[model samples]
Target: MAGREIVLAEKIDLHLCWEGKQLYLKPIPTFLLHHDFFTHAICTAAAPPGSTTASSDLYASACGFLKSYTKLIRHESDLAIAQEKNLIPASVTWNQWCDFSADIVLNTTGMILSQRYDYGELRLTRLNLLYEMHACEPFHWGDHRYKFLLDTISHEWLLFTFVYFTVVLTAMQAVLATQYGAGSVGIQRAAFGCGVFVLVVAGGSCVLMGVFVWLRAYVLFFSETWIGRQQYRIYYLDRILEALVLSE
Candidate 1:
């Protein structure tokens, strides 16, 4: 059977060998990836069958560590936020942290598995790794608040236009009210009352629009952050599965 076919097979446990050691190979933990269970099945299928190899023990241990890691960083919790803020090492960029974690997991797993397997340097290729990394990236907003606002405003042109018109209308009404108060218009009392009413309505609309924009930006940012966290987890899991499948 082809590699992908083997991965999708039903009798996966029949193929996994835990190094003849009595180590308990745990079931795959829940991950943030889209097809997480399928990925786990692939890992199980790719493991060499009926071998008392040391590589099996290493693979099992690595899998255990990964499960624990996922639990510790569950969803977009405080720990995840803190890690995003400060857990980055000097050797990697902030955005590259997930990719770096993948490298660590895959390299470590591959190095252990290669002890008995005849991979012959047929490890997971850089091109495939880069593709997976790029594919799992979260949607990025610009760094600065002003840039984020500008980008959001550009995308929300309709709402922005409405806000802009209201502000312009308010300014015009204020100008008329001032002119009438200065006795420049013949019907001063009537013009002043009309201008004041228009000013109040226009000003109120501007304020409401401003609030809407603020709320929209805040919600979008929060949602993106949550999605980004999940994507990072998926990227990590993908790398582990890729290493196992490609090495096999």
Candidate 2:
């Protein structure tokens, strides 16, 4: 087959600010409506005639909107992580925090690289998630509820596994039916098919549920288990940021 140019039709750049911190984004913006872009785009709209910049209020409003947006996102993200944390003992410390941070950063970076390299999409809607992935090095990925809900919505992994196993189960049912003779088996043939289908769906759902639970655990106990491992990484990152700030 011939190759294609592959222009970035869905790409967008966004800037979010809160508590004096700013995060820049270059992500696909297909999900947003024109109204949704109003906050960030207002910076351009508020510019005075013949001027290159907008008024402070526009920027301020953008920041305000960003703060609200961040709150909502973090709230949702924290839900899963919080549930996981609730399961852990209350004696977590600084060493545990560092180790958790290191493990998550390493694992998440690898996952991102692997998925994006193969599938070519990083579809986190909120900028804070990227920051958490890149900057905070959070042990908790997000709320566990979101994992299952989003997977169902996107059918990203769960759907794929379900469909794959469903087909296999159907094939197995058919083979067994043929071996036993569908006519001779009568209603037993239908029951076998139904059972296979039910088992496939049930098993797949259980497995998906287990994966989400594990992800929740990792996020919840990450600080407890891995912060000690991340001491050097945190130190280096802080030093680099300090150097950058000083240079600026």
**For each candidate, what TM-score against the reference?**
0.26, 0.27
lDDT of 1 by residue, 1-248 (tens): 11221111122122222211211122323341224553464355345544544445535544434433333333345234434433212333334445534544564443334331221111222322233247432232213443434332344765675677568556656666684545566555555565677677668867876896677566656766878898999999999999999999
Which residue ranges in model 2 land beyond 4 Å of their true spot? 1-48, 54-128, 137-157, 179-248
Q: What TM-score number comes out for model 1?
A: 0.26
Q: Which structure among the candidates has the greatest TM-score?
A: 2
Q: After superposition, how far is residue 181 of candidate 2 from its true place, in Å?
A: 9.8
What's the lDDT for all of these models?
0.44, 0.43
Which residue pairs clash within candidate 1? Answer: none
Instruction: Name the runs in model 1 displaced over 4 angstroms.
Output: 1-140, 150-189, 235-248
lDDT of 1 at 75: 38
Worst 10 residues of 1 by lDDT: 1-10
